[model samples]
Target: MTFDATFWALIGLILFLALMIYIKIPGKIAEGLDKRSDDIRTELEEARRLREEAQALLAEYQRKQREAEREAEDIISQAQREAKAMATEAKAKLEAYVTRRQKQAEDKIAQAEAQAVQDVRTRSVDVAIQAAEIIIADKVSGKLADELIGKSIKDVAAKLN
Candidate 1:
């Protein structure tokens, strides 16, 4: 009997299926797909691990940076306090120096005033002694008068000085 095109096509389809089954191409394909899926899953896990590691490193760096900033701020505040203390100390020293200098100047002035008073008193005593000698010489003119005058002058000099 002579078959139509449909019969030959059906035969071709069956032979192709048999040939593919004999070669185990479907099983190999399935195995290949499973292996590829496993490889993709492993790559995804590795990428996820790397991402987590990067995030952890980022967090650690951020923490360290924050600590460094805090330390820097603390150091700055400490320096400011030290500067204020130093300024206060310097001010105290300056005030002490100024007071000391003022006291020294006052002492010098007092010394000058005392010296002036002493000089005036010494000049007055000398003038009084000279006037007394002139008056006595004019009033007395004998040897006894000269001896008494010398004795009086010595007594006056001793008492005045």
Candidate 2:
């Protein structure tokens, strides 16, 4: 190729024009660059807000953990109290049942004793009347025998009392 001054000069002018466009022409062509930068800053602030919200959620979960632990403890304590109350009630019921059974057994024993004493008294009375009849067969009047028996019953009753 053959070099030419005019060609070189034209290339220099093109380069200079391109440099001017790169440095100064965009500002003149677009007026919203500052607004774009403000929008990007607002986006960064929104991201920070979202991070804070996530941290608050983590803190809320931790608080719920503590509350659940407290509730578990309270439930355990209540269960223990109920168990103690049940034991006390069972003991009282058992005691009452035993007392009632003992009273019933004592009443039965008393009734048996009274029936035995009455049967023995009836047998003794029959034997005593037979003896009296034998002794008084030809020796006493019926009215005198009745009086003697009445006196003997009074003496026995007084001694027993």
Candidate 3:
């Protein structure tokens, strides 16, 4: 038989229907493939978002670490300054205490010297009075000597006051 347009068209349609039936593939299979591709795309997008979030967290942690280090340095410096100030104050207090003690010792020494001089003067006066009494007792009668000595002592007391 000679080939004709109508015959080829009919043959093409029969072949196409035969392939579809023989493979037993339904139309829903293509739709399922498309849906699976969309699911894979969405999963990839979620993975990218998670990666970005992790990067942000890492950056924040680094910033916090730097701040902590700076704060530690500041605290150490402040402590050093405070320690120096305390040492200075202690030194000044020690010097002041030493000066006060020295002044007190000098004053006590002066007072002791004055008291010793006063005691020496009083002792010398007592010795002089005893010597004079002994000389008078040898020179006169005992009763006369006693009366003269009493009168001299009263006169000397009046002159001293």
Highest TM-score scorer:
1
Candidate ranking (lDDT, best to worst): 1, 3, 2
How do the residues 1-161 of candidate 3 rate in per-residue lDDT, one tens digit apiece? 89999999999999998888777655667778888999999999999999999999999999999999999999999999999999999999999999999999999999999889878766766776788788887787677888999987787667644
- Error (Å) of candidate 1 at residue 12 is 2.1
Q: Write the per-residue lDDT of candidate 2 for residues 43-70, one digit (tens) a residue.
A: 9999999999999999999999999999
- Global lDDT of model 1: 0.93
TM-score per prediction, in order, is 0.81, 0.66, 0.66
True-structure RMSD for candidate 2:
4.5
RMSD of each: 2.5, 4.5, 5.6
In terms of lDDT, which candidate is stronger, 2 or 3?
Answer: 3
